[model samples]
Target chain A: MNRQNSNKNNDHRDDFPGSFRSNPFHVPDHYFDELPGRIKSRIEQDKSRKRLFYLRPVVQKALLAAAGLALLIGLAIALLHERNDVHVYIGQFNGISAPDIEATLLPSDLDEYTLVSFILETQDFTGMPSGTDITDEEIKSYLLETNNIEPLILHY
Target chain B: MHHSDEEIIPLIQDESTREKGFDRLVKAYQQEVYWLIRRMVIDHDDADDLTQDTFVKVWNNLDRFRGESALFTWIYRIATNEALAHLRKKRISFSFLALEKTSTAAIPEYNDAFYRSDNAMRQFQKALAELPDKQRLIFNMKYYDDLTYEQISEITGTSVGGLKATYHQAVKKIKKKLSLE
Candidate 1:
């Protein structure tokens, strides 16, 4: 099969009768004489390039990965610091009790239903308020002791 | 300066005589390797650059030679690889559109002073350029360089039978392109 193909190619070449095979390209004068020196210089230049700053692909990838890891760690640390700051600010009210939260609630902050529940939880069915000797602290204590009502209804 | 591989390998291995050995190797194989690359690239300048790259690789990697193949075959393999890599980087292919682009742009104009003024040669080059990269290499190795199928197989890592068939097909294609078929 190979011989047949070769013979066919030969016959084709014969039929063509003008297939030029000699090298048609020409180089600059003295190119061959100077090529060895050029190659040597290039090799030296590459060696210097390696010595200066050429990093292997593996090393470059590792450096990128390390940098990414460091950035992630830094962000995590920053988030934890912010979280700790919030904890510290909340801890500042250590001496206060739940009454302080209830004391800060505006009238607008409580709906009418909550107001009714509050009233039922705090006061007895003694109708409207009269000019009696009922202290605010006594009312609060009744709210706390009678129905186990939490004084802190307003969220922060 | 015509040192055999046995003589050149030792010089390359030795620290003192390495440069001298390499010089001889370049002198011995440079023309053959250059022409091989030249045929593949079809431009003298690109071929020149790739030829230098091939030798530089040879100089750096000659120490790894384990005598599995002839030194020249190893060098041919390196040269072939350099040429193919350059074409790949430049996105050159042997498709019809690619051939048109190469003929118009990549190939040095005949008006260039270094280009030969032979129309037949140019036509043959055009016919050769129409082949795919591997087929072109096979044709160049077998038809032009007169390398045996086994030697080409070593350089290209293709089986001998495959290379023979490829070479024959390449010839047919070139012949057809040249309007000889």
Candidate 2:
């Protein structure tokens, strides 16, 4: 009966001539024995990779925020510096003493004609009484009465 | 560890039981996954790397598993995708080194005393390597893994009728290539 069964198996093989019963591939010694450990290590490595993945965006966001903060601070410093310059410029005029103001006046600004003309232009004549023309002898009498005359010459 | 997917999925889903459950899942499915990739790539180291890659994807994506398919099928799908992608890259980069041209030389000799000396096995592997990628996958899954059409369908997203036809065509091709037609 076993011989007959073997014959039947042979007949089956003959019927399907392309059937393969054996594996052609082979793995190294104890490959499966170490496969579990390798897989565990690979998993640990993958977890580390994932940790880096999670940290990357956070690091990028932090750097971006820091950059933005630095830019804001730089802009604020520039604005404050500009404001200080304006204040110093205004203070040059507003905080000066009278002597310093006179010291800063140009030679042309101190011209007698120019000063008198400026005074005449600025004075309000509406409160003053109207005056008639005065004679030179009247000016001389006033100077003599006030003892403000110099005796050098009425002829010149 | 040898529990059904019903028992395994919950453990993988729960944080407390997740690692142990994954270890058990790997222990159960590693051989199957390895052999599937091994037959597809025909290189041990490549197959091993692809196997690990497949499991890693499974570990990362287990939370999104909806139980629409069997756990093994889901795992197989991941393995299949890895193998096919690896092959696609290998093909493009090494197109000049087409396996069919050097199929005989591609058979690796192992360091063991148990090196395969069978001509039929060598011929079978060569014939298998000559098939198109999907046809080879169908043949390996159907003939070698003894996977059912429904299971293969779930893994491949191919219909049972289509897979049957593909398997039939692959077998015919292999038989003709082996001069057994």
Candidate 3:
């Protein structure tokens, strides 16, 4: 059976005319000589590329984390500075009287009624002059000196 | 000196001697691998590139070689796969064209003095070209490379009986094609 199969295989070869074994292909001279070097260079390049590929995302993540931390630090510093300014202003007000504090805090353009109400709530009336005692000229002079006449005239 | 696989494999497996061993390996088998690919691809440039690619793969995968098969067979397997894959990609990208035209396009120009006078050679090459890529591969291994069914089977991972049938079919087709021409 083996011999028969072998002969049959030979028969298939016998059917074809002429040898098909002759190589029609040719390469440039020294192609084989230079191929190893070329392949080595490619391997080296591939190794370098793979190293970079592994390292790239790590480097990028580290940089991103650093940038995010810097932003958080800056925001915290800004918020702390604003809070400190508020605290400083509050500390300065602790030493001043209520009238002085009201004068500094209130707008100069407050109307007479609002100003009187605010002072009545906060100040002592024992030493202060009454409205009937003060002449119209004295009131006008006080308003002028305080730069509050324009708002009073506009209000009226 | 021609280094055997026993000598080469050990050198390559060692990091210190790896490059030198690989260089020796390439020098020893480059021609065999080149011709194996050249016949399958039928174009010198494609074969050259595939041969280089095969060696690069061998280099990358050298550590995993368990010595279950001959190193030559392993290398041939790589070269074969590269050729078949190249042919497959070409077929897919150029599916719009007729198979005959696609195969003919791969034929080297007949400007060579040897090819210009040999009509039989040209007809035979054309017939071989027309076969399916795997069938053509089988035919080339048997007819040109003179590899046995057992060796071809080892390289191709095809059963011997199947290889025999495919090779027979290839021979019949080439004969018919030649007679028709």
Ranked by lDDT from best down, the candidates are 3, 1, 2
Clashes (candidate 1): 0
Docking class of 1: incorrect
Per-residue C-alpha lDDT of model 3 across residues B41-94, encoded as one tens digit per residue: 766778888988999999999888877888888998999999999988887232
The per-model DockQ list reads: 0.17, 0.11, 0.19
- Model 2 C-alpha lDDT per residue in residues A45-112, reported as the tens digit of each score: 99999899999999999999999999999999999999999657535644656555455543223444
> Better model by lDDT, 1 or 2?
1
Per-residue lDDT, model 3, residue A76, is 100
Q: Report every candidate's CA lDDT.
A: 0.73, 0.71, 0.75
C-alpha RMSD (angstroms) for model 3: 9.7
Off by over 4 Å in 1: A1-19, A53-156, B93-118
Q: B1-181, model 1: which lDDT tens digit per residue? A: 4566777877887879988989988988888889999888866888889999999999888778776778888999999999998988987754544645555445443334225646555556667777888898988877766677877888899999999789889877877766762
Which candidate leads the pack in DockQ?
A: 3
Query: After superposing the true interface residues, what Cα RMSD does each candidate give?
Result: 7.1, 8.9, 7.0
Docking class of 3: incorrect
A42-111 in candidate 3: lDDT tens per residue? Answer: 8888899999999999999999999999999999999999999966864575477766756654655446
- Model 2 RMSD to the real structure? 13.8
